[model samples]
Target: MSTRIEVVAGRRRWTVEQKLAILRDAFGPEGSVGDACKRHAIGSGSIYTWRRQAMSGELGGARPAPLPSFAEVELSAPVPGLPTAGSHIEIELPSGVKLTVDSGVDADALARVVAVLTR
Candidate 1:
């Protein structure tokens, strides 16, 4: 008979590459998120968040894209003489904050924007 012992201390940190691999398996045709989560000993929420970050280009990889960043937004009232035309939509947050954005806003960008606004 053989006996082995292992000791673990501190929180586990996952590297970008590891995260990417886990995400690939979680989302791959032959793998499921539940399976990946169990196999990697991580929560589904973490995997989903990593996937979201990966999509927004926060985690660098072969597919390059813009990183999520916050910019100084200047909110001004519409001039009385000017016409509010073209394509624009109003989004009212749960906190009762209204935002006017272009109709063609990117989905990922909009999601990040909404996350910030909600916070």
Candidate 2:
């Protein structure tokens, strides 16, 4: 003789952002869907569902943008010693070489600014 058991669970819907966030965290370095589910107290099936939804564009219209390539940026310059927008300033190093940089700027802008300042 054998006994049969039945289980019933309700389906809980999550927002698209919420689902994507979970999927991103779930697949982090050294992490898997199973591990993520275990760590976050979610079901493995939920992760699979989210993955499928993301692939099919069923969740939302949102998608990650492709990263820009180096060729996309231009590197022309006024040279490093020049100034712009008051945000950047020029400084002469101990070696008597001038450098220009913004108070807080990104690498691309910093490089351009430095080129202008050094020129």
Candidate 3:
């Protein structure tokens, strides 16, 4: 029988700056925790630990902001003969959120903006 051996790497040491950058990327706009973990070659446990440290002011910086969630928005084209690019429609949700959308705006883009604002 033949035996095979594998070489293991030593533990990686990350500086405070590196950790903070990773934390920011994980929680910043358009950031994904999974993606950040993969890019930094770390696990969720480390990310969570660093996040907790940051929140507790142990990481030497302010806590990372939470990622915004998304909601759907529906829009309709502006009525013709308004003498402008498009008409504006204002909506006020029961949650006290206000949205002013141009009827000529793209539905998907408007949806994304509304989603971010609502979050």
Predicted structure 3: lDDT: 0.76
lDDT of 1 by residue, 6-90 (tens): 8889988999999999999999889799999999999999999999888666676545433345454443976665435567878
Please give the CA lDDT of all the candidate structures: 0.79, 0.66, 0.76
lDDT of 3 by residue, 1-119 (tens): 99999988998999999998999899999888999999999998999998878765667755534444445554387556543556687768544888887856766777677566544
- The model with the greater TM-score, 1 or 2, is 1
For model 2, the stretches where C-alpha displacement exceeds 4 angstroms are 1-11, 61-119
Which is the leading candidate under lDDT?
1
The runs of at least 3 residues in candidate 1 whose Cα sits more than 4 Å from the true structure, single-residue gaps closed, are: 1-8, 61-119
Question: What are the RMSD figures for all models against the true structure?
Answer: 9.3, 12.8, 12.0
TM-score of each: 0.45, 0.38, 0.45
What candidate 3 gets wrong by more than 4 Å, as runs, is: 1-5, 61-119
C-alpha RMSD in Å of predicted model 3 compared with the true structure: 12.0
Compared to the true structure, candidate 3 yields what TM-score? Answer: 0.45
| Clash count for each candidate, listed in order shown | 0, 11, 0
The alpha-carbon lDDT assigned to residue 34 of candidate 1 equals 97
